[model samples]
Every structure is written in C-alpha cells, then in structure tokens.
Target: MKTIDQTQQEIVEEFSMFSDWMDKYEYIIDMGKNLEQLPDDFKKDEFLIPGCQSRVWLVPEFRDDKVFFKTDSDAIITKGIACLIVRIFNGRTKEEISKSKLFFIEKIGLVQNLSPTRANGLASMVDKIYRYVK
Candidate 1:
C-alpha cells in the first residue's frame, strides 16, 4: 500500500496540473463526486463536525489495526476536501495516520485559498480524524 506521504504527493502533483483556481475547484468538486456515499445512519449529531459551515459527517472504523474513514458534507467543496483527507488517511494504521503532517494541503495552496471558515473546518476534520486514532 502507498504511504500517506506518497498519496499526498500524488495529490499535490495532480493539483499542480491546474493553472487556475477555477480548474482546481472543478477538480475538487469532481473528487467529491467520486467519494463513497455515506449512509444515512452515520449522519448523526455525534458524527457531525462542529466548525464547518456545512454539515459534515465522519465515521471511522478500526480493523486489524488499520483505520478506514467514511465522510460526507452538504457542501461540495467541503466534501471534496474531506475526500482528499480520506484518501490520505483511510486504510492506514493508526500510528501512520497519527504521525502524518499533511503537507499536501499547503503544497496545493488549499489552506491559503480557503476562506477562514473553510480553513477552520478543514482543521476540524483533521482533528476529528486524530481523535479517532487515540
């Protein structure tokens, strides 16, 4: 399996291909479209991320020492951001997930481009994932 860094590098390279933020935004929306559908049962208040402008739900499962995540958001961009994070951390060991620095977020200019609310939401998502690891 590819390490989280490898996966993040791949995402950075993919984002680098876009010349403009419009294209990047479209790509993110496409990624969100491809995200696995989260079941209705998992969209409870317990799974809801608190800092998001949209309703974001995350459910994690730990199996054989690996963590798998399922996430969804009412907003397309938020869902796409979640998809990026899920791609990096899903199916990874808890130790691996916990230690990742998530440099791709900066390399892809996601943090700088995001609105303050969205940026906070992104941090919240990362925090939620780490909480599951502990």
Candidate 2:
C-alpha cells in the first residue's frame, strides 16, 4: 500500500490530468472497483457505523505497533472510501496517525461531490479511527 502522502499526491495529480468532471468520476469509480472485498461477517451490527445511508462496519486491530482495519459497506463507493482510509492509516503508530491530517479526500475532490449524509459518515469514520489511535 502507498504512504498517505504518496497516495494523496497521486490522486491529486491524476485528477489534475482529467479534462472534465465525467472523467474524474470515472476514475473514482475505477478506484472503488480496486478495493478489496470485505468479509460477510464483518458487516455485523457490532461493527456497524451509524451515520451512513449505506450500512458500514469497521473493525480495528493492532499488531506489532501498527494499526490494521477491516471494513465493509453496502454501498460500493463508500466501501472504497473506507478502503482508502484503511490504506492511509494502517501500519502506523497511534501518535503518527493522530498527528497526521487526512487531506487525501479533498485531493481526490470527494468532499464537494458527496451527499451530506455520506460526508457526515466519512467524518464519523475518521473520528472512529482517531478514537482508536488515542
């Protein structure tokens, strides 16, 4: 997986190459397609995230000083968004993660496009991750 800075830069650069919003949307959907599928059991209520329109569940685990996460969502796009967060935060120490800013979502131009509920869900998910880091 790429580092947060690398992923952010890559997404920004990629979007910069697009001539239109249609192309950008296509790229985002493609990115969603590349996310790893979550297991059926991980979608259970114990892991469920409450704010999303789609069902989202996230489980955090720590190993060898690194944080690892498992997540699933009923919506494909949301799942991909969760995957992006996992890629950014996983394998980092709690302090490192807490101190870092998640600017990649903005770099990918997601904040402006997502619905209010979805955007709130994203924020909730990030808050959950930070809570674990603390």
Highest lDDT: give the candidate number: 1
Which digits, one per residue and each the tens of the lDDT, describe model 1 over residues 1-134?
Answer: 89999999999999999989899989999988888788899999999988777888988888898988889998888899888998899899988987888789888887752344653577787888988887
lDDT tens per residue, model 2, 16-128: 89878778777756667776677886767877877777777889888999898987777777777777777778788898888888776776677753344654477778888
Off by over 4 Å in 2: 1-3, 113-120
Q: Model 1: how far is 108 from its true place, Å?
A: 0.7
**Which lDDT values do the candidates have, in the order given?**
0.85, 0.75
Question: What is the C-alpha RMSD, rounded to one decimal, of candidate 1?
Answer: 1.8
The 10-residue segment of model 1 with minimum total lDDT is 112-121
